[model samples]
Target chain A: MDFVLDYISVTTFWTVLFIVHALLAVALLGALTHQAVAVWGPVRLASTPGGSAPGFVTRFRSVFAPSYAGVVCLLWVLAFIFGAIIYTKYRIYVRIPIEQQGLFKTLGAFELKEHLVTIGLGLLPIYWYLWKNARNAVYDSSRKWLTIVLAAICWYGFLTGHVLNNVRGFGS
Target chain B: MSAAAQTQSAPSDRRRIFALVFGVSFAVLYVVCDMAALPMFTYHPGSDRIDLGFTPARPDEGPAMYWFGWIATSALGAFVLALGAALLPQKAGAKIPLALAWIVPIALVPVLIYSLKFYWRW
Candidate 1:
């Protein structure tokens, strides 16, 4: 116990958590991407990806949208929860330096990213509801659009976090 | 329909109303809170304190972050509104346009981007 505690300093602990956060975000990005594409137009997805040798893109967009609702919501919440935790450390270390160094664009992008993600967070419940009701024609339009919006948010967030991590976290 | 179907429908109806109301209201309220800087609470990272309303860097601390509080404000306010919407008679909810779920937030995207105009390069 003493040796393990000594080896993993606060910095190491935060770094590990940061990596976990990034991994969760990546998983979330993939899940949302697949759902968004599949939910378009006809608002249909294969019950079991049944098709006659569909192309890469078609196969990519073939997941059952309803099955994804719960997972997407869970991942979104987990990703944000982990993000909120590491955000405290980020404010103290990375953000202040980024400001002092005059990386306004990068900082600004993150600012936008945070707001967008928060908006995306607020969208989760409805996204879940719409997807759950995907079979009902009344919700089809709302389902498609909401999925696209959530996907867009996840993409922007993943990209911004990637770039910022490149500037900071990836080094370790 | 059967009794089971009728029983299931009401709660699901209320849930759909709640989710949609929460979605639309949170988006609108978040933008207002963020732009106005009227968060439910503010977190000063340096001092390790979360104060109610906005506060400066106090005696010895770095910048204060209102982002968390902004989220809190929108979420809590939207929660109250959603509960009310869900509790309303089903007839009242039927009048709500489903498009508003995605539409309002989608429209506000640009406004939010505009709000961050301070960070724009040119």
Candidate 2:
């Protein structure tokens, strides 16, 4: 990869990319968590019997939930791209040797993580649609269910990626 | 909404449900197929290395057959399932989300099994 800054070394290039990917993943984790909570455990305002006004966090979550679709999709895809770049170095240095060592569980975790990332990408469009139209009562159940499933996928990918990173640090 | 309007919207609603089912199921099914090593086509970059008739010089440096093959396999699977659901009667179509609520989770089982199988050598 050609560095825009001549002073930047190849190691720095990849390390920066890894850092950016990590940041994006962290943001995605927060967005999905808030959205999931909003869907499955919405808080009602105690002051109102009709539940017309939700509590502060619940109100924030509701606003945050619908807005997350676009941001999550963008960041997730960008993270995937960064990961693909990082994977080239990882395959030879980290993955192959680890596999040779018979540490299949860690390898398997990384494998699943990659697949889940791609699968989540595939769900992006529908996820956005459901969130965009969340106010439509008829689609409420579908949206909630989809939100829960996507959040589950994100959590799976996040946790697995963390485990694999611990097993073998990125781009080593 | 009037009764007539509700009736008119029913088919569209069904179509939306079918679309959602296809999208979500395709994603899950694709990964499951990949995890289970059920690629319709095989190309190991390090060995023989010819996937879909394309060869990469090194196994470590080659096209990812898991990706292309998974896309092909999952697309076919999702297409067939969606078509079947689309043809179901209107009442049956309405149940697609409910069906998926359970079906998607069941579809995830193979991924877990595949991961464990490698670890345990079972």
Candidate 3:
């Protein structure tokens, strides 16, 4: 442990964790995108139970929505955890430069992204339970709109984080 | 009703109400706490200090992070509301418009964005 510690530095550690964080965000992005699309787009639903969801778009929406629920929740949490850890790095490194440069809109966007992610985290349990059991009939529209909203939040968070990185990436 | 039927219905009702209560309460609480700056604690990154309750940074303390504390306050408040779901009547879930699960959050989006006006130059 002491030997490995000597071989590493703070920036190196943050960089590794940040890389994992980005990868998790990408995975989370993909999962949420698919689930959101399937919920909104025309597809074979569990209620209906049988049909060929051919074509590029149709097959994309054809996957079972429930399966994505648990995975999305899991990935959301994991990405959030990693992001939270790397956040200090962003604060100390990237954010000071951003703040100094007077990018208020960019800073504002990131601020809102934090709120969006927190809200999404709180909503996960309910979202998972709804999708887990009732993805149809009375709750069909509920599931659709809920998925869309969450997906939108996620997309915003991802894109904002991406843009911020472009402005002043880690270890800046 | 039969025992099995009663058992099944109870959980379904509980779940529905729990989801509604948690979803609506969390969304509203987060926004309210944020706009009001009612954080549970403040983290001053420069001074490396964690001050309980929402507080402005002292001189030379640098930018304080209240976002984490706001999240804490909202999550705590919303969890209490969700817990209260158990005391609700079985049919209570039906009374809560299901659309609120998404509607409240969507409505909050604009408000959340607007609250950042201080950060916006436009």
Candidate 4:
């Protein structure tokens, strides 16, 4: 940890790529969250006393809930590609040395991050299908679970990426 | 309930099954190849491991090939898996197997994490 500043130097190329990757991850995070909220809800005005109208924001998100699927899937893959590129440096330099230095907890967190991201990739198709057919009654239960799971994965992955990047700037 | 409607709907069913197979296969194969094939081919900077005939890419070189390998292997896997899954019965009740759609991906969380054992050394 103490050596982080001394050894980690962010090059322009890596920094630019990191920015692009982070932006994509953030966009993916927003899309997934918006979609999930649409699924799990917007404190329905109908559920409120006197049964008022839903907010404009809630109405708008719900309308586009089915659309987030493809964008999320695409961004998820792109972010992973960027991460993979950055990972080449992390694997040899940052990660190995961190493990060698015995920062087990930090390293373990990153391990979980990698696992979650890859697992998220696997989940995309089902997630896409569930959301695409969100209007259908048969897939109701599965769609709920899938959306919740994907959102959770995105949240975890986003936080983990940020934490790791802060610890040692992406491939610096 | 007309003949035209029946003809139209049949292809959608085929497409669904095809999508299921291709998607499942792509994800599974990508994970598998990432763990096995890509690592085998990527030349680690400092290592004494013998290359069994096939040359590995230099650790610092050619990231494109690694990415390419991932896409190509998964495409190959998807083609094969789609063909196999398509051959299965497409009866209404038979879609029970597509449950693997959500199941396998969820299951893979642990499997992918386990591969980190090589790195974690714990």
Candidate 5:
């Protein structure tokens, strides 16, 4: 009984993390599935010219649009804040004793570059692309594609930078 | 159809596709990142520092404050996206996607509240 209790105590954070993780996973799947159904499915169905817009699909897309966009943006922001909180909770940047101080110094320098500096630089392009496309009266395919590409790059940089900064358990 | 012809042929369809791609890609990226960050959070209850991913600290000191902060941030993002969705041209064909976009944020409120209050101690 004592052992089980100890295990639970040690792993409580994992359980919480898993629950939150799972919730996020489901949310992502739902967003993807909803988008797939709303966007791709209808286009494929209406392959023939002037097919009257696949009645039911048309109705569904109109109803789903605002909710889909709003939810996605909300999720993105929440994830970023949550990640930031996690970073704050863990002394990920602190120097562990017995390690060469030089290594910690190197990591500290990298951390600033990766998180603060790089993120600021990345955000400029992202915001610019978003703002530029947003200003247009109609959705320009070229601009839209550019926004997607920029967003993908930003997401990659953000995730990779965070992961690299948090490496632990080895030599600690 | 020619490129220009295709462009003119189905404007609504293209818009719908764009929204779907953007939404799905962004959501998947978020999920992957959150999962990757989970392991760092594993720690003892009373430990001074809790690992969240990028940094470690004592989050328990003020859980309520951060919880509300998360909600406010999420709300702001949702509002901005919803406003954009609202500005899109209204057509019978565009209704379902628009509605879906709006519904996404509404669905999140419950989830965020649940997670925030998950292990509350007061």
Candidate 6:
């Protein structure tokens, strides 16, 4: 049992973690590519028929769309799982020295709070907008811009918060 | 306009131009953002410095390199999407900048992961 735990605690584990990370990264990229083609390719091609764009977009989307959503959701879940594992295995947050503990703990707590809140509250509204506006003829560029902005905000929040929390050496 | 002149005019050219511009611009932006986020390349932090077997004490250590790698990956995806968009057929007047918009966050995921990992260790 100790050996197993030790094995799990090695840097090799992180290497594996990174590999899985890379795979999910690919899946997420593929999902975005698939979504983009589905939503935009047809429209672009409609303007330039016999130009090969439309057929390619249709084929790519057809191949990709079926698994896109599932893969994306899986990617997020895996990321969270890997994050939790790293946190526990390293004793990173809990083991910090008393003087240094407060800041690290605060940052980690804040990040957790932020992610939970954004996924729980923010994503719902975004999804609602996508669904409701699916066929709406309104040519509101602002809506697209708003979605992009919100995604950017959420992404930055996640990035900065994670970086700040991890700055303190594990158990420093 | 003369009859021959009208026949030669392409109604869809404007939309095609727009898609090309949007697609190309998004690709360039993705590349730039990735470059900005990447750590300047350096030797891998030696294993002996810490129990974790690697240490990157500063942003210059590996951040920029990883960021650019991520951007490259996402740029590939955006390229595919853009090509598909430019090739695929659709409604006569659909104006969605599909490939461009999706490329933003797709390129962002690896950067985010790198940031998280760096934070976990930094």
True contacts kept of each: 0.65, 0.18, 0.55, 0.16, 0.00, 0.00
User: Which is superior by TM-score, 4 or 6?
Assistant: 4
- Assess every candidate by TM-score: 0.88, 0.73, 0.88, 0.70, 0.32, 0.34
Superposition-based RMSD of candidate 1 using all C-alpha atoms, in angstroms: 4.7
User: Predictions ranked by lDDT, top down?
Assistant: 1, 3, 2, 4, 6, 5
Candidate with best DockQ: 1
Candidate 5, residues A121-158, lDDT tens digits: the string is 21222233333344343434333343333244334434
10 residues in a row with least lDDT, candidate 3 chain A: A44-53
What candidate 1 gets wrong by more than 4 Å, as runs, is A1-7, A41-52, A170-172, B1-12
Report the C-alpha lDDT of model 1 over A54-100, residue by residue, as the tens digit.
Answer: 57887787777689899999999999999998898798789877777
Worst 10 residues of 2 chain B by lDDT: B48-57
Better of 1 and 5 by DockQ: 1
- Give model 1's DockQ, 2 decimals: 0.46
Alpha-carbon runs more than 4 Å astray in model 2 = A3-6, A48-64, B1-18, B28-65, B72-95, B98-102
- The lDDT per prediction is 0.83, 0.67, 0.81, 0.67, 0.38, 0.41
Q: Going through the candidates in order, what is the number of backbone clashes in each?
A: 0, 2, 0, 0, 42, 15
Model 2: lDDT of residue A59: 69
Clashing pairs in 2: B45-B59, B46-B59
Estimate, for each residue in B1-122, the C-alpha lDDT of model 4 and write its tens digit. Answer: 34443344222355556666776677688678767754223334344233432256556443222434455567667878776766767774246455566566677777777766665555
Cα lDDT tens digits for candidate 6, B1-122: 35553455333333342444344444444444444543222222222122221224444332111322333444455456555654555443245543333344345445544534423533
Predicted candidate 6 versus true structure: per-residue lDDT over A1-172, tens digit per residue: 3475565765565546645644654554455455445544333325665565445646775543323444444554565455444534333333344225445444544443333322322122222333234433231232344334333443454555445435643323
Q: Which is the winner by TM-score between candidate 1 and candidate 2?
A: 1
Candidate 2 residue-wise lDDT, B1-122, digit = tens: 34443444333454565566677678777766765666666545334244552233454464344555666678678778767777778777775553354346447657555655656552
- By TM-score, the better pick of 1 and 5 is 1
Scoring the B chain of model 6 against the true B chain gives a TM-score of: 0.34
Per-residue lDDT value at B36 in model 3: 91
Q: Can you tell me the CAPRI class of model 6?
A: incorrect
- What's the C-alpha lDDT at position A166 in model 3? 87
Q: Model 2 fnat?
A: 0.18
**What CA RMSD would you report for each candidate?**
4.7, 5.3, 4.8, 7.2, 15.3, 17.0
CAPRI-style class, candidate 4: incorrect
